[model samples]
Target: MTPTIRGFEHHRVPVDGDVSLHVAVGGSGSPIVLLHGFPQTHLMWRHVAADLAAGHTVICPDLRGYGASDKPAEAGPGTYSKRTMAADVVALARALGHERFALAGHDRGALVALRAALDHPAAVGHLACLDVLPTLDMWDVMHGVDAAVGFHLYLMAQPPGLPERMIAASADAFFGHFLDRWAADPAAIPADVRSAYLRACAAAVPSIVADYRASAGIDVEHDRADRTAGNRLRMPVTVVQQDWGAALGFDAASIWRAWAPDLRHTLTGHGHFMAEEAPAMIAEELRALLTR
Candidate 1:
């Protein structure tokens, strides 16, 4: 009972050194790549990818350290930097014959998409980010109440071996915590999919932590350099997010506006896994962004 995207053809693509991604391709028009968030695979795009596939060539990939993709041995800075991961996404699209493609990401995947747009503006026709802020803004917005909500980010950002050991001890509980707590309706994630996510995470404790650790260190430095140079997303950008500003007492839109000069920001009461919790809306917003 392996998870499969109906009607989509799957392929393994080599992007970086010994790191290959599992990508699902469907449809036959312009290309649109979808990146999934943490503790989930490209399966997160099951609904949206199918919808977008009706009129576009939708590409969904299990990002480097997650899903059926290669985890790779932890190698410090460059191992799972979003910049490197973002380049993987761009290279993946190009290898598939798309010179430029519409891009969308959820959670961690959103961070990668943001980086891709900044690092290779000419390659991204349009961008959509579901339920996440830029990495730098994400760290800066954390304070009292919100910090409590982001405890895992701090925990996973710890030195290697330590975080991996702790997470491995209670893998299911640790991975399942966010899947249950962050969703408006936990049932939105089918039981089998939930089990699949937990299993993938439990098996790759070190690489998963390395992915987060890069964000705490190198990812931030990369972001700082971009900000210093006044780099902004020149492509049309659309963001869909749960109202973290309302709950956490920070201005979410203003923070995102600083990075996306051409922006469409939508505040939703939908859950953090918005693609699953609200597919039609997510699909509509993404289509709207490309039409611009």
Candidate 2:
């Protein structure tokens, strides 16, 4: 039977000046902040969060510029940087009365989680990243055949005004293409959920493009500076991903090891949206990570 995620209470809390997040909170125990990836919202964690809430308090938030969160126009380089997004997570957790909490992020949220660990090592007690590599390695690994796997990366990585304009022109087709192509089982996401995602992305075009553009520019500089400073994720880290790196001629674990000393890496058969495609397995992996 498909699970139900109806009881959780939704909230809109201020993070930084003029920016707030629509968050869902449920269960009660040690805190675990669940960060959703791009083209998705906190609803991505519905199944997983419901399970984890049995033994933990789960806080799932819509990242800025996505879902019901504030979609303010980009205010400068600092506004959409992962560093700033990470700080928003910190503030959200603190606002919820969690001084330190375990954090897990999928896709784009994984990037934010990495930044959170580096920027606020004392706050994120345990870290889990699903289906992504460090930004620098990600850029270095994309070429030739593997390049096709992340067409959106290049598309959204384009300089400012142009990409945003093009994407806005064909919003549904651009976003729907990823929805159809990436899912191992399209039926897994019901039409309502899919429509919700499309509408959210469509409405947040400028901010969404700016977020990706920042990754191609300032986010890369942030990652390179961290590497130069020898900054690493201080918490125990668990990574679950499909073997994209091996298929693309890069050692995924080795790349992650450079950033996280205590790491557990697993290759799953699920597609890019592992949390939704294989929630039970993802939940088990998360449970084990928390225990360790």
Candidate 3:
């Protein structure tokens, strides 16, 4: 028999005077915050969170400007930075009575997790980054045809009004294109989940584009500052990624080592959406990371 989904409780936690997040929390035990990436919602972690919740409390939040979260029209200096988003995660955890927790994030979420680990080292006990590189290295390594892999990065990185306007004009096509291209098996994403994600993206087009735009601008500055200051993720770090470096002629582990000294890097054959495509493997990785 399929187990009943205990479902999730909606939460509105203030991150700043004018900003707050729409979070979903369920289960009970040691807290484990699962953050979703771009073109998806916290619902992406439904399978993994349900499994983890058996032994741990799971907190899943739609990052600012995505899903059910507030989408502020203004993208101020601190508004969309990963650093600020990380702080939102910390605030959400604290509001939920978890001063410290194990944190894991995929794609864009991984970037926020990394920033959280750096910004609030005392709050994140363990860190797991799935399928991303540090922002600067990601930009530094891309070139010519190889850069085509992340074409959206360049498109969304463009200055202000244009990118958002274009994306907003054809939001479903813009968001669905990545959803279709990145998944190894589209069937892994259920119909409802797909529709939900597309709807969220359509509704949060400006903020979504702003989030990526920051990655190309302020986020890069933050990563550079961290590197220059010799500040690395000061926690046990587990990274699961496809061998993008091998395809593009670079050392993936070496790149990760620059940011995470206590690192366990695994190259999986899984596509970008490892959580959905390979739940068992993703769970196994998370279990080992949390245990270690």
Query: What total of clashing residue pairs does each candidate reach?
Result: 0, 0, 0
Q: Tell me, by TM-score, which candidate is best.
A: 1
Q: Please, what are the lDDT tens digits per residue for candidate 2 over residues 119-192? A: 99999999999999988889999899768878888888887788898999999999888888878878777887
- 177-233 in candidate 3: lDDT tens per residue? 988988988898877788888888899988888899899989999999989999988
What are the RMSD figures for all models against the true structure?
0.9, 2.0, 2.3
lDDT of each: 0.91, 0.89, 0.88
Q: For candidate 1, what's the RMSD? A: 0.9
Q: Which stretches of candidate 1 lie over 4 Å from their true place?
A: none
Which sequence of candidate numbers ranks them by TM-score, best first? 1, 2, 3
Stretches > 4 Å off in candidate 3: 1-6
Task: Mark the regions of model 2 whose C-alpha exceeds 4 Å error after superposition.
Answer: 1-4
Error of 1 at 14 (Å): 0.9
lDDT of 1 by residue, 23-113 (tens): 9999989899999998898999999899988999999999988888999987778889999999999989988999899999999999999
